[model samples]
Target: MMKLGFDGKVALVTGAGSGIGAAVSRQLAEEGAEVVVADLNGDAAQTVAAEIRSLGGQAQHIAVDVSDPDAVERLVQFVIDRCGALHLAVNNAGTDGVRKATADYPLDEWHKLLNVNLNGVFYCMKHEIAAMVQNGGGSIVNMSSILGCVGLPTASAYTAAKHGVVGLTKVAAIEYARMGVRINAVGPGWIETPLLLDHSDTVSTRRMVALQPMARRGTPQEVSALVCFLLSEQASFISGSYHLVDGAYTAH
Candidate 1:
């Protein structure tokens, strides 16, 4: 296996306050990349950045609502102004939305879910792509879910938004391939995140685990490993693809 490194690279990871996002930020920093830990929760973002600094890694925190296009644009600009270039990005900010059947799903809730999970990724990608192009090239990893490829009861909105991410990733990857930008989507299974752990006893959680061939939930570090690889030169020829870290959850 080839050892990967992000020496002198600049990376931006949204939702970096916790879970897979935080793990990715740390991993990138460990690999010598100057990382930006971005999240809507300012304090959480700052905490993560502080942790990275303590580990002797270069990192900073930025607070922004990814659902807002203006905020997304400003995020890119802030990175450039501070770091001088934007080379790697992981659009990991997302929400699970309200759990309800499609017919019973609240209208406002649907819009809210899509705005962050789907539109948020789009907004980030739009500005990130422009910046990457100007910098000559870069890589992006959009966080999707195994739900993106399969349906789940009472998760209609979340499912739809994730599916949309996979589609959007494909289109963006193709359009930007010639320009040297490689964009891809990552479909994670039921990772052991705080959000999932909080619902560990729920029927939905049990069902999710049973579907996985591994018969257990994955970890944030596991997903982060894949995201970092996709963002590195080791995956040079990989683009416009949806890589799943779901422990064969969808194998059936």
Candidate 2:
């Protein structure tokens, strides 16, 4: 029973205040990793970290806007200063901008979504890879989405950013494979996260459900399981690919 072994590792998960990111942070903590729960919401990040601590898990929290390269640098540095090494990271922070047809999409909205969704992943990876290389080796799981592989109407910006994430993951993984850094992307379907629920109406939700062959949305824990496995030694040979946890939403 290898159990995805993380006995003595330091893991950082962004957007970990809630949903899949939060679940991954907690699960990583349970696997004996010192977890750093990073999110844009300072209070939310602290709450999650405090909850992990209450459960006797070694955990910490930080508020970081991943879109800023400078802030991302500071974040990785913070992890090094506090934990001494960065063994694993999940660049999961992102946003689903307002829905609109590509032709009707607002220019500001497009930039805003890309800044956090696509550019943010790049920023985090840029710094995380450096820290991991310095530490000799590490793993990373960047959050993509079902949209990364396919397109959805009225979600032009989100779809584009996610697709970009997949490309970025592939290029980085290839570049760092020989350097002891394995990078991969996880594409989650319509998981029941605030990112979807907060933006969807009842009818919209039902429509999304119908789109999935599973006829339901996925749970954060389900996705977290996959993310943790990828970040663990069990997945040492897996890198430079996009793994989907979608409920077969893209099968059709």
Candidate 3:
């Protein structure tokens, strides 16, 4: 509904093979952005890209591990070489799904979680910002979590990593504000993504919805709309901020 601007621009989206990442990539493609769908599952990424092309959208696909600095660098360069420029980037790759309560969680488990969710975001921003600087300016949206602001049982690693994402987003936003680049983050609450599938039929999602004043979990598309606006020039004044698209989950 915001009718954001992406006409002729190029976007790079990670974890875009499914769920919220897929939704974001589709939304941008629909808005005339030439999107590069990056995911750990190369086949899935290719599938999404093909679907976008079928829907009268411009899209490409690439396999990337956002946690690896070298992979991130190559991904950025691929976008520039193929798409001509990189005006938008969404750092959405992460993991921690096999969530165990802190008391039972292993240190190695925690390390793996942080490697993807926190360090991965940092790697993406480092390479993406470098490219954006060369192109004058651009927009970046980092995927955080409602747990980034609030705490929940059995989500210690995820919470820590997401909070790190917010902190990283803020720092980058401030450091680059004067350079025409806007960096921000989205803290999605109980969204309908693959990450929630394990908890879908369980008491967790329902409990999460109950906690939300809106009384429901949000959809991938719902979050995508907010992200689209942030990437648009319309939100030029909005930067360095973490927006909670939680349907008032944090309000209570």
Q: Which candidate leads in TM-score?
A: 1
**Residue 177's lDDT in candidate 3:** 89
Q: Which residue pairs show collisions in model 1? A: none
Badly placed stretches (over 4 Å) of model 1 are none
The lDDT values for all models are 0.94, 0.92, 0.91
lDDT of 1 by residue, 104-190 (tens): 999999999999999999999999999999999999999999988999999999999999999999999999999999999999998
Candidates sorted on lDDT, descending:
1, 2, 3
Give Cα distance to truth, residue 240, candidate 2, Å. 0.4
Candidate 1: minimum summed lDDT over ten consecutive residues — where?
193-202
Answer with 2 or 3, whichever has the higher lDDT: 2
Candidate 2 backbone clash number: 0
**Weakest 10 consecutive residues, lDDT, candidate 2?**
199-208
The TM-score values for the models, in the order shown, are 0.98, 0.97, 0.96
Q: Give the CA lDDT, 0 to 100, for residue 104 in model 3.
A: 92
- Tens-place lDDT per residue, model 2, 116-227, is 9999999999989999999899999999998899888888999999999999999999999999999999999888899888866756556877778987889999999999
Pairing residues by index, what is the TM-score of model 1?
0.98
Report backbone clashes per prediction.
Answer: 0, 0, 0
